[model samples]
Target: MANHVYTAAALAAAFFLAPANAQASPQAALPSAEVTTAVDDVVARYELPGIAVGVVVDGKVRHWEVRGETAAGSGERVGRDTLFKVASNTKAMTAALLARQVDAGLLAWDDPVVKHLPGFRMYEDWVTREMQVRDLLIHNSGMGPGAGDLMLWPEPNHFTRDDVIAGLEYLKPRWSFRSRYAYDNTLYIVAGEVAAAVGGAPYDVLLRREVFEPLGMDGCRIGEWRISEAGSVASPHVKRQGQWIARQDGEVVADMPMAAAGGVRCSLDSMLRWTQTWLAEEGDTPHSGWLSKKQREAVWTPHMPMPLTSRMREWNKSHFYAYGYGWRLSDVDGTAKVAHTGTLSGMYSAVTLLPELGTGFVILINGEAGEARTVLEQVLTKHFTAPGQNRTVAYYAEDLARERAAPESSAARQSSGAPVADARASAPRSIASSSELAPWLGEYRDPWFGDVSICPSDSGARFESANSPRLSGPVFNAAGRFLVDFEALESDADAWLDFANDSPDGKKQLTMAKVDPDADFSYDYEDLHFRRTGECASQ
Candidate 1:
């Protein structure tokens, strides 16, 4: 297939010269056959259950290519109107809502968080007092990445917004306030509460009235709403034993405690409109009115420096990367790119914007297909950033093959004597006898997260959480190390249970960490510090 790369200068000139109303007109050309072919190849290669791709050029949705079933065999085809959870992409919209509040003179970015939520508090007293509203959006809170996320996920949990807010004071910081960059979702939840406190309405209500309604993003849904009323919604899927299985049935009737951080369902049409709002220039009627010129700039401006990963360096030759309010700001191949990716269980979404060329694209997938998203993002981005280069699915497939075949790094080899596959195959799968599990049997408690009970089960030992019910599972022994194989398959976050060597005062304490290092950071099992409080309750 021929590469349909457009030069940045040429694309920018064409976009600027086009009539203002051209954005809504159907004059823009559709995506090239190459783009469609690439999307098909990725879907086939990754076996993604459903995907919705939308491209916006010259501030208009120029093309859309939706394919596959809402669930693997449900036969409900994904359409432009089919809602998929955009996850953390909702953060940008949350930031926009705060910006609207700022525009209305209701809140300032630098205002202390306590000014809005009087009871707001962080781990450190001084840090809590000094923390500003903008600090909540940017991920420089000194907390480790995805800290305290266990309270928010494995959904249908009992944790509430107040529980999340109150838990903040107990989560110990990894570093001093504003000392370095570390991504966090809990703070964004706090930001949402701040918006609600100032806006005199719930976060979802404020989002609907201030952003969604004004921007015509009618298909987006948040907070508590029945699945039946959701119209066409995509089910989240995960691959197990080489088969794609639906996890959640797209029912979100219960309130999402982390809704501000990552719980918004949107259709391709609505996402395109949201993208267009950001692509619009200052004084561009509805879009510009969404936020003042200053706030618009504020949301996109880089606030904290992000470490350049090997992927970013090699893929886009990106020099620097940082987090803005709700977006990531970076220069990709000499063109400024503002973007954010949302990942939740089996749902994934990415929104990329090239402001200089007035172009952006949204990729929403209702499956565990992060690799597919990466391949598509690079292929789409390279169309403008390095148009001359043809990086297709085949290219990425070969690249990934090479990466997989390469030997593990020295550091990796040293960390684990044997490969993960080898270790899993050789290790014992279950506890030997009930007597062996006695030392670890107890009701343990963490400060932020509530209670976890380890008790003898019919099979062996069982692990259960009080606040997070989905964490219940059988305990497995891997090379003398204890691990919890969560019964909730959708979570895919099995964690190792490590006990402290010395029990001061005869009290046992344990720490948990993910068995798979690459599991979602939100698993955050390593952040948990559980102390054996007492014997497990009757059951």
Candidate 2:
């Protein structure tokens, strides 16, 4: 095990920042043996390709661990500076960049977004006029969760920032503006644009200058970079056929339109520094001069109420939950906690901060290890929240096991008194005949998503998106319901085609819903309102 510890003096000197006053005596050296054992158990159990864990206490990095290969069988070992896409954790940083603008009198949080981007518009004219800059960070825009995300992901899509702004005007709201919380990423992309317009630089340039540079976070990169030039980067992986498969090993870099929302990449060492900045005493860190106390407080202030999940209630005894600017605010045990988790196709990251305890930890992985991230997060959080309780990874793993088994316990009372099968089992297994699919074959168009066509294929029919090529897949009949099973393994979402009975305008209207309830919200198929405009064009 390679243990890397940064002293207060070293951090201060490296960043040219003042040391925060010690809040409490530094905790005893982290139990390296216990931590190692716990991490080993999780890696073995989940088959994680690579993971990096960093713990900070009293404004100093107390523990750092990097384990396994960057990609399964890649021969590249995980290192302190191995870059992993931090994903949505980039939101908090973007929020901070906005706060910096507020400090400089460039823009106010409550300023109408149209004041900066005159072209900005929402589906509702009133919302377009009323949306504030602050509204961009909180998830209360009335747009449903992950609304309009198809444009930003299955990455390397052709969508640009201007395209995202234009698409918002067509994203109909599910509720009244600010009526409830439903997380969406499109607004954050807009916020990044706002920052760029006001700061006289691109989003990535502004972030690097305002946030990364001042804090000495040299390992973080937002925009384009050659893979060969990017040192020691972790490769993303997904499980297929019970084996981990690398997603991309070639040298192709795609523009990240989602850079402001979920596109920053950073290493464990840099992430620990970022976490320390938040946990540090006010006005003590070097970048304190760049961001004002008022703005900092505003970033952490609750802006929207969030639903409290059963897991949070059971694990943290959380009484209330809410969304702050970029972080989720809640209480664990009785201590105030602020945190966020970032997820991409096969990457996962969790940052947990116990403000009252002056301690925090980060977990970064390069595989689809959501369960492992959860248990490991609980393990580290418990180290501070319930130190004497001695909850280890195994303990939390067992707890997760019990939770998974609970559904089975209630299966006896279900209709069949049997275990629930895969979600697709309820659909018809027989393939639909070509004639049955003939009526559905046509070229359809969505205002925001451009065009998708259902055309004849060897397998009866196929679904193809013009802008999002990864979404092309075969249309199958499960029972009688026609569904599209996307061929791109990374684009895991599959949707069912539901055609509306009445075509008031003489154009057959079709809508979709995810076949899997747990599909990532980014697969916002439900948001697509496709109208059959004409017959499919020749291939």
Candidate 3:
């Protein structure tokens, strides 16, 4: 796993000097202090629990540093090699693995997924047959963003790769198949299985051999088991009571089933090597051969166009935004920018590449704040180009303000046996008691997410979901609906379970909605359709 290491002096020698035939700008080649100051300032202002920053300039690690602690409570300072969950950044690696299979002639990018894995399917038969391997990498599967994330988040599930594939058949599409771009993680799980079927090895095993070993990523590992064993990993934290607090060990484990989509963990050392490999002038490299020029180009080429309504474009001064294989492709200051971000419960990271300038940066944060992108913007400004005077800084400061104002951030205040201020202030005057909820006791089921049982307990009733025991909690009647509190989760929001006899048979159906508007959009409970089907409800 060992590869060449370029020291600062060696990097200066390799990149600052031009060939005898060509000229290079010495002024532009020297390292600048602007990038370091910007990164440090962002971390301090955001109160990020821990952060690791790595910059690859001209195929070498010109800047690498770790600042802050492994956890909020622990005073242990993070080392350069400390492992942090890269989350959805793993998608690019998955795409890279697929590229390798293509290079080996084991699979084609446009081949229908069914050709590689039998029994693979979606809500519609046509979609199942026409869904190509490339479709899996892009976000145009017609399923809404984070459509089925509840099945695997917060609490790890007993589901396997087969279970994930089976659940897809029941997931109804929010948009016509392939009509629009909606990010969905479930398809990536299917893509990982396709790699297994075509590569003749398990998904994790295939990646370790084909991607990690070849790239000299000695500290990198995929999935929960591998990550849990990786020593000296930075502990995840969440902002609570206006301070960062370490997440309990019981809830900090990675979602193993969703590994393909967002479960790779590594350090800055490995990430810098990865950045250099992708920024290779020519795609061919003796150290890594899985991604060819064409393959690399294919992933960076826009596969689905983005709506650009988001603030990301404004901050980066991008003309348009679109999704490539596993990367987000756009033009910042008329220069091609390729990047992707990753997020778990309390971990956030950003990996960006500037192919035109032969520069790239990887930022890993052990907290939930998405300031990585903000920090990267500053780094780009100092190294390649600047956005504008005071423009990016003002935008980033506003973002930090929003994160602090969010209701979930006052979690510690709510956890102290007090009603959430926003919830209490806006709640309706009339409170429905347990007696009013008598008609709602039943077992309900969703085709994709399985079942939930609302059974009578001493106080009110206990609520339990099939694959999500961590979401089990006490249910109370409030605002004419049943409010279930998931004590196991970090947030203080209550899940509102609304019931109605809208079914043709008048059998009563239940659908869930998050009462807190500030709740993370990934908790897409509103997508579920739960129908009553048990003797308890009949009585």
Give the higher-TM-score candidate: 1 or 3. Answer: 1
RMSD of candidate 1 to true structure, Å: 5.9
- What TM-score does each of the candidates earn? 0.91, 0.91, 0.85
lDDT tens per residue, model 1, 379-482: 88887667668678879777878887888775676584422432552476766345677887889998889999988878888889999999889888877778
Residue-wise C-alpha lDDT for candidate 3, range 230-295, written one tens digit per residue: 666887887878998776454245447888898788888998888888877653356645567677
In the range 66-104, model 2's lDDT, one tens digit per residue, is: 898888898999999999989999999999999999999
The lDDT for every candidate, in the order shown, is 0.83, 0.82, 0.74
Please state the error at residue 163 of candidate 1 in Å: 0.9
List, in order, the clash count of every candidate structure: 0, 2, 0
Off by over 4 Å in 1: 1-31, 250-252, 410-426, 490-492, 501-505
